[model samples]
Target: MTNENRFNFNDALLTALFGTPSRKNTIDRLGIVCPVFPDEELRKSAVILCERIKKMDDFSWTALCKMAK
Candidate 1:
């Protein structure tokens, strides 16, 4: 029902295409420089997280995080 976006998609694309704003621009903007976790690292971390999360009561491997809106 609400957005939790950190950066606008257009701004992100501009940042990717042109890099960060120049000092003359003098305005704050959000952008992606690099992934926080690369593919291998993300896979490993997800494994660990899933292992821990499975210890919770009444959790199921096939369970959906949320139903479709």
Candidate 2:
């Protein structure tokens, strides 16, 4: 939970620090690369969402990514 808001979005270290993103970030980047994600208006704060995503195990996180698409 360090203040990494300014950290480079393209840095290899982003995954290392924040852990793998849940179904959100990559899906956002997907727009036309894939379909819309499941929830577009859940409206959770980014800080809270990132913390929850980080707590997920690797397998669960991967599953979410696939299901998102």
**What is the overall TM-score of model 2 with all chains considered together?**
0.36
Tell me the whole-model lDDT of each prediction, alpha carbons only. 0.31, 0.41
| Model 1: residues with Cα > 4 Å off, grouped in runs | 1-38, 59-69
Q: Where does the lowest 10-residue lDDT sum fall in candidate 1? A: 60-69
TM-score of 1: 0.28
Candidate 2: list runs displaced more than 4 Å: 1-44
**Residue clash pairs of candidate 2:** none
TM-scores for the candidates: 0.28, 0.36
Clash count per candidate: 0, 0
Task: Write down the lDDT that model 2 would get.
Answer: 0.41
Residue 55 lDDT in model 2? 65
Steric clash pairs (candidate 1)? none
